[model samples]
Target: MGATQKMTIFKLCILAGAALVGTMSVAAQAMTPAQTMLGDAPSVPKNIVIMIGDGMGPAYTSAYRYYKDNPDTQEIEQTVFDRLLVGTSSTYPARVSGYVTDSAAAATALATGVKSYNGAISVDINKQTIPTIMEKAKALGLATGVAVTSQINHATPAAFLSHNESRSNYDALAKSYLTTDTDVMLGGGKKYFPVSLIEKFQAKGYQYLSDFNQLDSIKQGKVIGLFANVQLPWAIDDNDKNKLSKMTAKALELLSQHDKGFVLLIEGSLIDWAGHNNDIVTAMGEMEEFANAIEVVEQYIRNNDNTLMLVTADHNTGGLSIGANGEYSWNTSIIRGVQASPDFIANDALIHDDWLARVSLNLGFEPNEDEASQLARARMQGKEVMTTSIKHLIDSRSNTGWTTGGHTGVDVQVFATGPAASLFAGYQDNTDIANKLISLLPKAKSKSQSNK
Candidate 1:
């Protein structure tokens, strides 16, 4: 068949899949009362927290279950995911952008309930601004903010707070955040906000913080904290492993003070970075950190019945698999022994005289003669090659498999809790998540009503 014919066939397959999904959704809704959609019910939430585990696919969660499992126990222990998983979400962007989605398009759909071309942030396919859930919450007199491990202006958070034709317009996104009326914004990307711009934010009474330690000192009011130059340090390498969790706690504390409640977007953003690098150690560490954040939110929801929390991913990255190369088992023990990220290990070894010692020490296991030779050969090639080699070796040891460094056109898992969470159950598209969230938000006041 010609290329055009193949493309037509692929699109047909996608349409057929979508039809099946719709049918399954109907079947799910008919299954039980707990799965019923509560449209405009009295149980509307006063607060909403949407947590995005960027690039986290089903496989990642499944892998995490085993990674956190206790070997001494006969049955595998269930994590927070097993307890609250509601359904799966298809993450395809607009038809024009094809099946697989980038973070920007996925975030746009999640933020605005509108699909857009990849790289567009909160803008429709026609390059016009679409209202985001955060904007809507602000309009309704509720507080709104975003907390992520990535730079606050990165694709996911940027989509929630700003409108831009391109996600790469980092400077523009940062500037836009100045007037977003967002109550709290925490993450990295101090470089994007120059002294003058930060002063403007200060002039507007936003308490700007550059140090992570300062997060706790401010007990009230609008706050913006930028903790790193770009993204924060990896979970495995950081002094505070619960950094995302801490941010989530602070966001909840600050946003909840608003009388009208709040809308907070918390993203485990570095999970995508680890996936893109095919670094299993870092991926697992990021997963653990993300889970910590989830626990924080889950507890908050248990305490606050008026809050709704939804957790989903933008798309699956690295096509992660549990076993590889004809292996029948994955060795979580090996992964647990990894003390640092592959890139960190590789860089440390390059400057050391005893490269094997450094490598073995970081890996927490001595390499065999053959493995040592492989490491030496990679070290000879240079830092970048050594990093890849280290990851490959770790993957081989742990039997972790990755099909690609880029994202795949796969359905990601959705988890929800609190009032109206059941409405998120069953098969749905990414935009459906945004649409449902938008539906639950309180109506914005008219200008004349505000004047009155």
Candidate 2:
């Protein structure tokens, strides 16, 4: 075996040992009759929790672990994913499209089990409306909820609950939520809906809330929590609040109370944003928050064997690489010096000639004489060029490298447990994720419902 293979095996063994120490017996005992062995058949779980880390790839997960480790020995520390992963999946869009996929196309495929055009929400490749897993779950009398760190109408979460020809139709998508039976919707973007529509939502029995502190008042019923006008602030900037984990835990609590069970979608939406910024510290913070939320789901799964949990990503962003500067070693600790993302620092704060001073203060370093000259020229060129220059300097100083400022056509990892998770175990198309979950769902009255 290659050296890398040996390392992976070692890590797996360590994970197995840790699981044994944790609660192997609790997991086994909690398995319901449906989960019992039926020859080669698997269980159809009553509850399904889908967690999408918006721009995660192997590099992102690996870098997350590096940051999690003790930095002294570089020994691994097992996260929830280490125990649950079934396999990996190719993130390509439909055969009708290109190899690369944005979150909209990928999330559409994941929600409806249909190959779709980029930006196609829950609509099919031909722009026809298709029933999503959320809709199917609702039709079967199962509770449905969506909790994400992104705006509720964003590509990933919107695909589950709304149908639109273009994901950019945020206002339309927000209005369209009135047409679905999705019980709970949380996260940002209240601005997309006008007061009339918001009142209509409240009139329709959907509780509309935006204050993050008011989440506890929701016990059992329909709710629409739009916490931010846009996407929620980065986890680093908002470190005092574990909003993602709180949202996930709250969704699980609300959805699991139904007698017929539930299906909920949760997202760590801004990992992709961090990737787009090529901000490693911000990405790490997002991943850490995401993992904390995943812990809540796993804890729930330990007692609720009827639930299936799938953790995956739509696509990779930033084409992030850990080893920059031709170094054999990785210093995840270098990120401690970073205070904010270039996007925030450049646009959110006061801009002045002394801006580089704040950059130096946050990044722990200042540009050399020649690099300073380049920044001046870029600023003189325009805001766009200046933004690009700032992000480049930030990444460069930290030994991080990004191939693109946008998404990549990489195959993201899939982690699963409960029910037919084994189906996700090989290289499969993005649509297969939705297909496999649809197949594992509680038997629908009309058999054709599983197909779309």
Query: 1-452 in candidate 2: lDDT tens per residue?
Result: 99999999999999999989658544643442223422232356778999999999879988887778875674688666666665787888876768888899999889988888888898887888998999888887899999998899999988999889898998989888898868889999978977999899989898888799899998878899999999998887785558999999899998888999898999999999989877787898899899999888877876777778888999999999987778666666667656765555655324765776876676666779887787778777766676677667766666778788898998989987766555566577778889988876677566686567
Show the colliding residue pairs in model 2: none
Candidate 1 C-alpha error for residue 140, in Å: 0.8
Predicted structure 2: clash tally: 0
Candidate 1 C-alpha lDDT tens digits along 1-452: 99999999999999999999899877764542223323333367889999999999999999999999999999999998887788999999999999999999999999999999999999999999999999888887899989999999999999999999999999999999988999999999999999999999999999999999999898999999999999999999999999999999999999989998899999999999999999999999999999999999887876777888899999999999999999799999999999999989999999999889989999989989998899999999999999999999999899999999999999999998777787898799999999999999988768898899
Clashes of each: 0, 0
Candidate 2 deviation (Cα RMSD): 8.7
lDDT agreement with native, every candidate: 0.92, 0.81
Candidate 2 off by > 4 Å: 1-42, 347-360, 364-390, 445-452
Model 2's alpha-carbon lDDT is 0.81
Q: Rate residue 196 of model 1 by lDDT.
A: 97
As a whole number from 0 to 100, the lDDT of residue 452 in candidate 1 is 100
For all predicted structures, in order, the TM-scores are 0.91, 0.83
